[model samples]
Target: MSGPELRTERLVLRRWRDADRVPFAELNADPRVTEHFRSPLSRERSDALVDRIEAGFEEYGFGLWAVEVAGSGEFVGFTGLAVPSFEPPWGRSVEIGWRLAAHAWGHGYATEAATAALDHGFDVAGLPSVVSFTARTNVRSLAVMRRLGMTYDPADDFDHPVLPPGHRLRPHVVYRLTAADWRARRTG
Candidate 1:
């Protein structure tokens, strides 16, 4: 689907491109980038993931966007909205997420892109709430969630249903932002 493009002060969140495939594969394969994932994706698997992301945009009008640096147009990574493929303890919900090249880390890109995505999900899509989750140990993502004003409750933690039992990344923490909360944060 030709999804809407979102612009931030330093990033552009847009649909994937043919040129994005190679670097995206590289990013997906980077051990640092994939540390939280099950494993680094093979080239074929990365391409397949891009295909699925595009299909998701087709079906939902929203999906993980290919992020690029604003002026340089350098492909960094992605940040956007998605529906979790597996059911979580909180039940079905649209999620906000991001992943950036290691070089893109510590620059506030994730939080900035994610803020725009949240605006779309809550303001444009009229979703009542959006959720985000990560391995309990992923402090970077957890901090981004807080920066975006998503509140976490320890009670919401759960083992990722897709992960094997006892997997280190199995235990996950969930954070959520309601439309009302988002509006308040924006105006207040």
Candidate 2:
């Protein structure tokens, strides 16, 4: 199914394609890219994730958009909204997230793409708020959350249900952006 596409001055956020699989897999397998995760993804697992990403769009009319550079059409990575089905406190929440290739790092690509996704959730989907969570040690991601105007409450931090108890990455911090806050930021 065809999904929504969003364009920025330098990037295009759109549906996945057959051509994106290889590079997408490479991105997922990169050590630096997946450093904060438990481990890098195998090709088989990477392919499965693409299938799920595509299915999300078909089911929800929105999902993580495959991101590419606007002028050169380079496949960077993905950034968009997702319904994270985890556990209590975070289950069934709309989340904005992203993953870009190592080459795309430090270029503000994540911030740009994620802002579009957050805007889509707040303006198009009419969501009340969107949340983003990452490992407590992932300072880069936390920076992006801040750049997107998401606020953090130390009390909202929690252990990720999917992660093993006592795992190094289990502790995560949540950031939120409400519709009212988004509007005020945009029009104020």
For residues 53-145, could you state the per-residue lDDT of candidate 1 as single tens digits?
Answer: 899899989999999999999999999999998888888999999999999999999999999999998898899999999999999999999
Off by over 4 Å in 1: none
Can you tell me which runs of candidate 2 are displaced by over 4 Å?
A: 88-91
Residue 9 lDDT (model 1): 92
* lDDT digits (tens) for residues 50-141 of candidate 2: 99999888888889999999999999999998888666475668889999999999999999998888788888888898899999999999
TM-scores of all candidate predictions against the true structure: 0.98, 0.96
Residue 24, candidate 1: Cα error in Å is 0.6
Per lDDT, the best of the predicted structures is 1
How high is the CA lDDT of each candidate model? 0.94, 0.91
Model 1: residue 87 alpha-carbon error in angstroms: 1.3
